[model samples]
Target: MIEEIDSMKNLQNEVGRNARLVGRILDRLREKGKLNEGVPLENGGLIKIELNHIANETVKEHFLEIANDNRILAVALNLFHEEQKKENPMPVILVSKDVIMRVKADTLGISSQDYLSDKIKNYDALYTGFITVFVHPSTIDSFYTEKHLPKSQVPELKETIDIYPNQFVIFKDSFGSNKSAVARYNKYTDSFEHLYSPESVWDVSPRNVQQRMAMDLLVNDSIPIVTLTGKSGTGKSLLALAWELSKVLDEKVYNKLLIARPIVPMGNDIGYLPGDKEEKLKPWMKPIYDNFEYIFRNRKTDTNIEDVIAGIKNIEIEALTYIRGRSIPKQFIIIDEAQNLTRHEIKTTISRVGESSKIVLLGDPEQIDNPYLDATSNGLTQVVEKFKESKLSGHVTLIKGERSKVAELAAKLL
Candidate 1:
């Protein structure tokens, strides 16, 4: 805690925005100190602040080999907990967001836990928009012929499984004769409708059933909010951009296509990067730009990339840091790398959507770059689980990597 406090005073050590926040806190400490005399304490609370209660030499020497700030704090905290145990029988648990630190605390016999207030669910149990259901061959036949199957058709299944609107469903034959059908649940009609999306978008076909299901959610105008979570090469961004380009350019359903990704919040050293915000962001946004080039090239647009972007003046790509307080209407917005966003930032970004706007959160929960966010606590998973029951939103987790043989192997093997 002491080392962290010292580091926060230096702009070079602290994050760009946290310096001012720490300064205000320091100022408040000084003001409160003047009123309270020698020691500063809260007005009325069981909790007490221990200032300069540094750990002893034994604990310090034990952590000297690691020489990291976090390890040092862990040593100090462990010592404090040990000392407190002598006076009281209360449990001293170490609450932190760092996984490694939690492990270290456990090694030292300290009770540690990840901060759970922002966590929506565990990564393994996260809501995937698609589910497979084994049913009678007669039900699959009826679905294929009638093109829709009422939820009542599977009354016994509902008692065991919960259904949500816009959820992708795959009905398989119970007898296992390879008879199957793919459908999407319609909460309004309470029926399973056949997948009705273009076979391909921007000349890119849905490579697998998950991709096909994702496409169904992407192009649905009725579903205003969508989320796609997957590893690299899963085509989350490609599918999102495909829909944005097709909708904004071909369909003209939305006035603009906006893509915003976190730059400074991704724990990258953007301060030392050359040029302005846009230039600094280019390297980070190169993946999105690459998808654009691939889509335009495959679509047979002879125009240059610059000219293409110039012609489609409705499309915008920039950093998420600049999206605050902006009301976007009739726009298709994609929040890329959304796994790096905090819960507060997610709420802020999603709330910026205006009437007629469709927002899609896209990223891999397993590949988060934010220091304080993990798969379960990140904005992507938060939205996926929280909005699963909402009719206006849908989500799909793409498992297959369609980028290339080598890329797919690396995404899995590495």
Candidate 2:
């Protein structure tokens, strides 16, 4: 136990070091005027970023091009567009490399792009874990019938497998393998029944095992709490919302669907953000609003957003702050940007869940907004890492962005 604690301490130190390096890179960008039009204050005071006066004309034009392409630009660009629209009719664009930024931008018809042209490798792929192997057609019997291959030669299984009488062998296969990849094996349904999806539960189709798991937890009345973690552009929030809507609107399983996300910023300070709390939260929650609008939009008729938002007390859009000291019952709750929350905050949020309630916390740890916590320390990661062994909990790391090929390639290459 002592050695394990020490190992965790060392890992924490290493993660902190990397986070500091990331902070330094962002600071350098701010100094070089690459981030936004704002200048950092000495005492964490008000920031003064010029909206129209960017240093490079080429970069500005590039931003304009991105805006023209129907991508939602950065927050600064969005603010600039709103401020300058009346004075000067310049196109608005958002510049960013973050996958969530592009996703949000495309949803809102704002232009956006990565400041850097080339894409970096997926960080998760670089981190080592249990290897997966795929077996060949005829090798199934050999793997189960014979002794399992030596632990060193065989790829380690990440999760427990249940074997039953006359189960099929499901082998793991990789890029390079002999006659077959790792051997295959199957389990019996007698021990634990694997749930299948209903044909018409608000277009709830699994398409894969992970999504199947998500759907199972969502549709089942027994499970009240579900948490999903993945990289940006994943269907974590989308799936949660879709499932919640299915329950509340389509099936009438729940009384209401309430969605809320944190209002944390990426960098610097929000001290100079003009206006009240609602105004401050508007920028952070724009993505949520955009999603709501997209889902509520009508193809045939011209319906405005206010009417859609007012359609039912059944669906509520709220901030995480307002959730404290409240008992939410008979409602499907989704906490987007949950990675920004602390352990205490998550606890508070979870405690508010009353009878006949389901809370789904969805966010990307890699794209965390909270500065004090890293990927491992944040509430979302802690929940996922700790609760993975629990039968009631499940998670999926989405690899594909079904948005567009450019967005997909950008996520991979740039």
Identify the candidate with maximal lDDT: 1
Q: Per-prediction RMSD in angstroms?
A: 4.3, 17.5
88-180 per-residue lDDT for model 1 (tens digits): 656667787778877877766778888888887467878888888899899988888998999999753677557888998888888889888
Off by over 4 Å in 2: 1-192, 198-209, 268-280, 297-299
- Candidate 2 achieves a global lDDT of 0.58
**Candidate 2 colliding pairs, count:** 24
Name model 1 segments beyond 4 Å from true: 1-46, 51-58, 64-88, 264-273, 299-303
Per-model TM-score on C-alpha atoms: 0.83, 0.54
What C-alpha lDDT values do all the predictions have?
0.80, 0.58
* Top candidate (TM-score): 1
